[model samples]
Target: MKLLLLRNFVFTILQSGTVVGLIPFLIVEPKLNDMLTQQLKISHYLGMLIFTLGFFMMLICIRSFAIDGKGTLSPADPTKRLVIKGLYKFSRNPMYIGVLTILMGETIFFKSYQLLIYLLLIFIAFNIFIILVEEPRLRRDFGKEYLDYCKKVERWG
Candidate 1:
């Protein structure tokens, strides 16, 4: 119970902090690419839309894996059950992919290199969290089931 609490606390703080940090950076820098260029571009909006779609896909994956039980927090428990449908079929870490997509979308929308830097930091932090905390918990909880899943799905896909 205590370990679950600690895991939730740490992940929440890290996720919230990265998102909060991104907001101000996005706001201050408006559509820079538009201002710099005389003509508008279709590709920019298309890219943003694609990222938004990916973000929602990640949300769906998270929802599908959610445990109604109190003991589980991180969706790292393979014993909790396997989620192979929807976005889970495509990527093991849809939530992280969604997070990355949001960051990428922000970078595209705001046209800010600063937000890109923040996105890189977010990636690094998430990578550490997955490696140190999430993976070990999954291995402990799910054992062979998770190992098999790992073999099938790429970590960051």
Candidate 2:
């Protein structure tokens, strides 16, 4: 059990960290001077708060995946059971929402048009992937239970 959780955590970090961490850092280029000045701005604080909240949201979703679903966020190591607990109770794709929220926070914090564009692009891509790929797979995998859950929960939160 510990080994599986560790594996899930590692995969979540690698996959989500690359998307929400490494890519944003490349776009942000957070220098000390600019960072110092930005600290005083309201947008900076707001962004930090949103980012922190989004990070926590992702962590909770990851925990749900590991504990309830017995898997990680990676498709290669997907949940054996459908995750309909935690944030999942409210939204079918809370994890994806968490990723988008993080991107939004980054765009706001950095005040970068490029980051905004990236966020928008990722949003569209996530929608497409969920509709065409993930949803169908979930339906096929979990059948009636997943469909019933879908009926009970909104796709996004």
Candidate 3:
């Protein structure tokens, strides 16, 4: 159980780091100094708070997936059981929400227009992926249970 959790945590770190770390750093870091002007001071604090919240939310959701659903967030090893507890009870796609929140926080913190564009693109892509691919697959796999969960839960929160 410990090993499985460790593995899941590693995967989460890798996935989150790539999406919320490396990409934004590469794209936004160059303009960071200029962006972090005196005027945007409040934004910096707000962004950090949002980012921290998102990070913790993701961790909680990931742990719930591993413990309750018996799987990781990776598509290669998605949760076997439907995760309907924790943040999942509130949002059908809290992980995505978490990621998007992190990205939005990054955009605000860095004051990067380019990162904002990237965030929009990612949001659209995630929406399409969830609607077209994930929902259908979940419907097929979990049948009525997933549909019922959808009825109760908001897709984003």
**Highest-TM-score candidate:** 2
Model 3 lDDT at residue 121: 93
Q: What are the lDDT figures for the candidates, one per model? A: 0.63, 0.86, 0.87
Model 3 lowest lDDT segment of ten: 31-40
- Report residue 18 deviation for candidate 1 (angstroms): 6.0
**Model 1 residue 59 lDDT score:** 47
Writing each residue's lDDT as its tens digit, candidate 3 over 92-114 gives 99999899999988987877889
- Where does model 3 exceed 4 Å of error? 33-40
* Cα lDDT for residue 146, candidate 2: 96
Worst lDDT run of 10 residues, candidate 1, spans 67-76
Error of 3 at 94 (Å): 0.8
lDDT of 2 at 35: 63
Give the per-residue lDDT of model 1 (tens digit) for 1-157: 5665555455544554347344635553475455547454674686578667766765465456553223322544322665555676677777677777767876776566777787798789889988998889777877897788898888876
List model 2 lDDT by residue over 36-109, tens digit each. Answer: 57435789778888888888899899889889999888888889999998899889998888888888888878
Per-prediction CA RMSD (Å): 5.9, 1.6, 1.9
lDDT of 3 at 59: 86
TM-score of candidate 1 versus the correct structure, residues matched by position: 0.67
